[model samples]
Target: MGTLGRSGIVRKPNETMRMLVTTIIGVVFGFFIGVSFPTISLTKFNFPSNLIPSLNFTYMDNAWSSVTGHRQVNSLSGVPKMWVETNPRGAERLPPGIVTPDTDLYLRRLWGKPSEDLIIRPKYLVTFTVGLNQKTNIDSAVRKLSENFQVLLFHYDGRTSEWDEFEWSKRAIHVSVRKQTKWWYAKRFLHPDIVAPYDYIFIWDEDLGVDNFDAEEYIKLVRKHGLEISQPGLEPNSGLTWQMTKKRDDTEVHKETEERPGWCSDPHVPPCAAFVEIMAPVFSRDAWRCVWHMIQNDLVHGWGLDFALRKCVDPAHEKIGVVDAQSIVHQTVPSLGNQVSRGITLV
Candidate 1:
């Protein structure tokens, strides 16, 4: 005799026994499978202690030319002699303090390497572009910088006659005023060495000075924050208060759209700040890509770089970082009356 329920099906004792076993088996099997397949980790990985000791930075074959208009090959080690001399300015031979890697300034620039075990100097491609119309401190700046960075100077003559000057010879490309087309002014031109890679590219104005600026520390923070575009706090030329736009506060942003109904609510956009100036903007490779693409070759005379950069840093795609620890001096020459009003869209 078998018990029948509303389903109108009666299970024999053997059938019932089989059903019970199968249910038990299914639960056990599922447990085993779950144990075998552990959950995946979503957290980003950082370099382990052991691995950090073994890593080294190098340039990919002939990578320098593409980034800074140098077409020829370049070696990465044995920094040029010009960089090691203490008296870069020759005003007076700086005490070994200026050139010594162990000095406080050097360590600060290198970001506090207590031992070689913690030091990781990522390779970089750096450049400076100066236009003829502006007055600049080219010689002193170059000599001072050659100590830590390899720089290629691009002069905007007309486009055809532009040449690149390196402290030492290498296969870097040069552009003249005529041939110095709009693309050269784009961020991509400053970082063409795609094969041998640098983590960051510093494209600065010639009027800017890098006093007390520590490159190594700057790089560490830039890498850690993973900012696409960033700047150090600026100091005004008059020695008055330096100005910078306040960062977008997440709370203030919410209030903004509530106050102004129908405000273009873009989850992807970051709030526009007070201003993005062009003094010494630091760019990660990611920032460079977006900036390079937005540059309009048609606007031949450099005008919209800052706006373009500002527009490119979307909250959904990139982060903006500012460093307050270090500052660069802007040699404020009075603006020669070319009141170029920057209408907003881009840097």
Candidate 2:
């Protein structure tokens, strides 16, 4: 509407509408500018998680990345990955595309996928150096282990076929190399990277009487006590070579035992503390890695390895111990000991 006045033509309502439109435009412009240019560095400061409403955290990450050219959280899935899960080889996965350093005893169908494991992966690995004579004892020992454990048997007497009589033998991995000592086989086959998938590794003798030992329960105790290197306590009367490995009737586990006087200079050292017999020792994945490297190629029988095991673990008294609740009979079979010819020229 226009009106004639001393000021010539006055646009009354039109001028009021113009003023209203300008006010609205100014408010909108200021709001967009404020959001676009934050006063603080978005990358340097961690904003309160709930500061923004109706926005996805990932979207916010992307928005911040787009604006500031820096993103603190790299994960595309919204939550930043605190650590990356990789193959044991890490970024150096090359050449062999089909297989990983980690292996399993799971059997696969010949016609289809080589990988039978998609859902279930065995969490632990239990290995035995066995002879046909100890089949019954080995059966009892394997039965003690749960389904979470994968069995691998090293046949020193070259009799893998006889093990098939047991139903579980079909699934058990057999590495038959006649007359080789367990340490020889371990050095070649159980490389740290090769067995990286297993949380714990049990390298045991076939003659162990495992009636009182439960592998799952033993693992629970090991974890509870933070034992990196351990063994089931030997029966008090069973070839009780070392006092540290002997079962104590009063304790669930024992780290130190009184040795014969004048034998040990330090009570906290091996054969008194931080000691486990090699016959039925169980090693954590990390401990085994260090022990495997310590194993010498020529020293096949693992002479003096019982004391050397203490070197693999620091504050050895704390990390190495015997679980008395799960105890085994040593049975001290002379299977490997009989190879006197090789033991003489052993390398």
Candidate 3:
């Protein structure tokens, strides 16, 4: 997990709760007497507080409800550090482990980068860009993505808050972009200190939600197909246009034939929607280097970025692949209009 901002330094974790109180007597008496419950600060909703303010009668009743809904107390002696439980949406319980050597070998072959002898670890760097004076659901979106993959978020603002708790524990580094300028955001992506350390980079918009995302598998697929540019799972209803091809063979209709149209990229695999949505797209070092060299220094802001990058990558011929297995839900609003008038026509 990671986050960045204007303070120029990664923000520190907020202090833990200063107080905690659990009283059966007070709870029973208050329940019978219908007493007014205590109120909690809005900041406390995101941060830990001294006491868990009234779950019975507080404006933050929802928060109280969520935090205390379930509690399981179990005492097991000398459990292995590697043990973990599955907290899936439903059917919550500790599942079995992949104890087979074949499973371990598959995992190693899938994501592990080449290391001495036999150790393999995937290398990745995640980059996020935020504009100043913006209100967004990005923080929550990022938190969800960080559960399985290593993530780093860059914020334009410098304010520290309790909501940043996950970043502190997850290893997200907060870097100040000074201003919310697109160039600054782009610059940090290429900053030697940042780029030199990672093998793969995933750049994305802030408002993207990954409902069933798994970065390890994502990378594995990318490498397996030998693609330099790859996109996350996409759905056609998401408002992005894709070029698809239709195959016709009426003479041979088999039982397996559903009589449906299939879609795909054009001969020159240029992206159908925005190239590099700046949200949830992964690029190999080879692709990033290709982009870095082609970016025109003067082209700094948002207008022509998508256009310039597509041209830079020579997308029509690159090993650009799209994954249909997983989908990232982008919470994007309707675009006002095309901001730049580059003469390129959309085929």
Candidate 4:
């Protein structure tokens, strides 16, 4: 019977066989040592914290550490992990701390005075689209509107110096941009967010005659009727096509008025009710925000915007109206159009 070897294989008991078995065991052990030596050697080298694979943090964790200037410690491992600290505070305090009356006077200089004094801001604002040639008409309108309204003139003629001729111009803000349309100036300059401090905004053309319009009375009617969007009534000879805009002697304020046949079936719709022509539109601050967004950036002429104004206000019929008590005449002068066309052709 043959004897079993250590590997449970039957082998002949020869010197050559024993020598071959010992050599095979040495070769196998040496191969494992060679493979493990490089890994052990790599652990001895100290790499940067960022290069270490196990120390990497998630994007959110990194962001939190950067903003708060605190390192994210591993809760489970209880190890101090390396992280970015953007606003590091190392034995230093932040300035402008707790602004109380007892604070040092030198430190208080960095902060402005407390809000104890009353600041009287303008209640209403009016923007007039004016040309240099219409200075006479603008002066007349400003004279009547300046007492109660904060006037802002958008001079399309590019002749800003001409405003200096009128003494009332001292109270107005004149912005002169040449050859641009009224709506163009309005979109670029009269943002609702900037003008939110005012209660009402009047966007009127320069040709309008405001002899009959009373700024104070108009605001009173607007508040009483709860009109978010409104305009003064146009005189009969104002060349206005909409019947709702025409001056009504019977009522002080009218939301819905008669229009030409087939103009609008629903009286609650625009051009009949819940509408005011763009020539002289007044908007509440909240309504103006919506309307300012609705004004297309490319549509500079603003011809079709009046029809869409009602969409910005809820229950448009009640909130939008024409105040007959504060009426004006739309001279319907084509001077702005004529000059703009000429300027474009010249360019």
Judging by lDDT against the true structure, name the best candidate: 2
TM-score of 4: 0.66
Clashes of each: 35, 0, 16, 0
Candidate 3 residue lDDT tens string, 228-264: 6666654444555333211113311011112223422
Candidate 4: global Cα-lDDT?
A: 0.76
Write model 4 residue lDDT over 1-347, tens digit each, in one string.
56687889876668557878999999999999987753232323567877775743355455555565654444566544443333233312222232221211011124466442224346788888887778899888877864546788887778887688777686578888776777887788878756777889888888899888888888999999999999998988898468888888999999998777889989899888998898889999899889989888887668889899989998998999999999999998764664646447311
lDDT of 1: 0.48
In model 3, how large is the Cα lDDT of residue 119? 40
Which lDDT tens digits does candidate 1 get at residues 278-321?
55666776666666667665754455565456566666224664
Model 3 alpha-carbon drift over 4 Å, by segment: 1-122, 131-140, 143-150, 161-163, 167-170, 178-183, 240-266, 269-278, 297-301, 307-318, 333-347
What order do you get sorting by lDDT, best first?
A: 2, 4, 1, 3
The best-first sequence of candidates by TM-score reads 2, 4, 3, 1
Model 3 lDDT, residue 160, Cα: 28
Better of 2 and 4 by TM-score: 2
RMSD of 3: 28.8
Best by TM-score: 2
RMSD list, candidates in order = 21.0, 11.0, 28.8, 16.8
